[model samples]
Target: MTTAIIKPQWSPLTIALMVMGFIIFWPLGLAVLGYILWGEKFGGSPEKAQAYWNKGKAWCSSNAPRHHRNHWNRSSGMSSSGNAAFDDYRAEQLKRLDEERARLDAEIDAFHEYMANLNKAKDREEFDRFMNERRGSRQGYDQNKPDNGDNNNGWGSNNA
Candidate 1:
């Protein structure tokens, strides 16, 4: 029988190292803290756990029926529940649902496109109106400006 070398596993030196690790590097501190808190789960021999897990997985895999395994392996969406009429009806229903989904997706895409076009047209109209207003105001200012000829002081100055 092999005796354990470390007595009183949570030694003061280990706690100090953990605290120092935390002060120096936060991740190291967190790792040390986790090891301190849940240290028991990591120990008690890894070979025993692996052996038990392998046995359980083998039992589960062996117990499953070949038909169920084949059904799972196949990528076909169709599954026969031992009734031909029901299978036919189920397949028809799935096909109809798929068609309806495709039609709905198309309609959604068309609606989005229509909304985008409507927004674009509205923006263009607003921009055109703004440009027209700017041009008209500039023309009005030019027309109201005083003539630069002689005796035209621009504030209605009478030279008489």
Candidate 2:
């Protein structure tokens, strides 16, 4: 009988490092930093590490926002200049976008008008007659030929 051998179960070393981290590092900052840094080395993929950090950060922020207040703020907070120049820049961008949209709309309208004029322009019989006349002038066909094969349907032996 054959027996199957199971590989050792994989477990992340993050928890142990985190515990030791709390012991050695002042304010447990190193522990958190180590978790972030060596998480992939221990057993996590970069994606998994990122996900774990994101979830952990969220939980930590909720439970103790003031605990790692600096890290928490750096991660979550946003800063933007409230200057008049910034507001003007935004206004200019919006105005340019609006102008571009208006120009595009006008171009679309012009194209539609051009297409409508083209579509309503000509009779099929008139167009065919014009083409046949053009071809005859260019080729100079033998008028005396019986042309029975061509039969005025625009094809076959001129002698016919």
Candidate 3:
């Protein structure tokens, strides 16, 4: 006597609910679809659910890449492989890689600063050209104006 409305079977009610879930929110729809496909494996029990989770976890760990699997050991530097020579070699390589990464980071910073300076110079050049053109236009306009000392501000007076 399970009270769950959504079962793993492809009944009309389940299909309708799945479609409605998708229409409302896509992730909800995807969840419903997942339940429809794999609900029987969980079996509506806590122990079954836990077992399923553990199985998936084991699969993921087993399928991970070699470097990823050894990431913790490499990063912590506390694990030894029982070979002194190999350990020394690995330490030396890691140190060299760190130094190289530092050098590259410094170069990247220098390049960014150079680009910023170049952009500033270009903007300054454009601004100087604009100012010069503006000054030239104002000078030309002033030179073309009549020198007659009338205070009408560029508009001629109607009184002759």
- Best TM-score among the predictions, by candidate number: 3
Worst 10 residues of 1 by lDDT: 1-10
Per-residue lDDT of model 1, residues 3-110, tens digit only: 444222477866887889899999997877776665555454677557666888999899999988877864375556888998899888888999999999999999
TM-score of each: 0.47, 0.28, 0.59
> Tens-digit lDDT track for model 3 on 15-54?
8889999999999989889888988899989999999999
Q: How large is the C-alpha RMSD of every model relative to the true structure? A: 10.3, 16.7, 5.7
Report the C-alpha displacement of residue 157, candidate 2, in angstroms: 49
Cα lDDT for residue 89, candidate 1: 92
Q: Rank the candidates by TM-score, best first.
A: 3, 1, 2
> On a 0 to 100 scale, what is the lDDT of residue 90 in model 2?
65
Tens digit per residue, CA lDDT, model 2, 87-129: 6786688689989999999999999999887776756667888
* Ranking of candidates on lDDT, top first: 3, 1, 2
- Badly placed stretches (over 4 Å) of model 3 are 1-55, 62-68, 146-148, 152-160
- Find the 10 residues in a row with the least total lDDT in model 2: 1-10
Candidate 3 Cα deviation (angstroms), residue 85: 1.3
Screening candidate 1 with a backbone cut-off below 3 angstroms (N, C-alpha, C), the clashing residue pairs are none
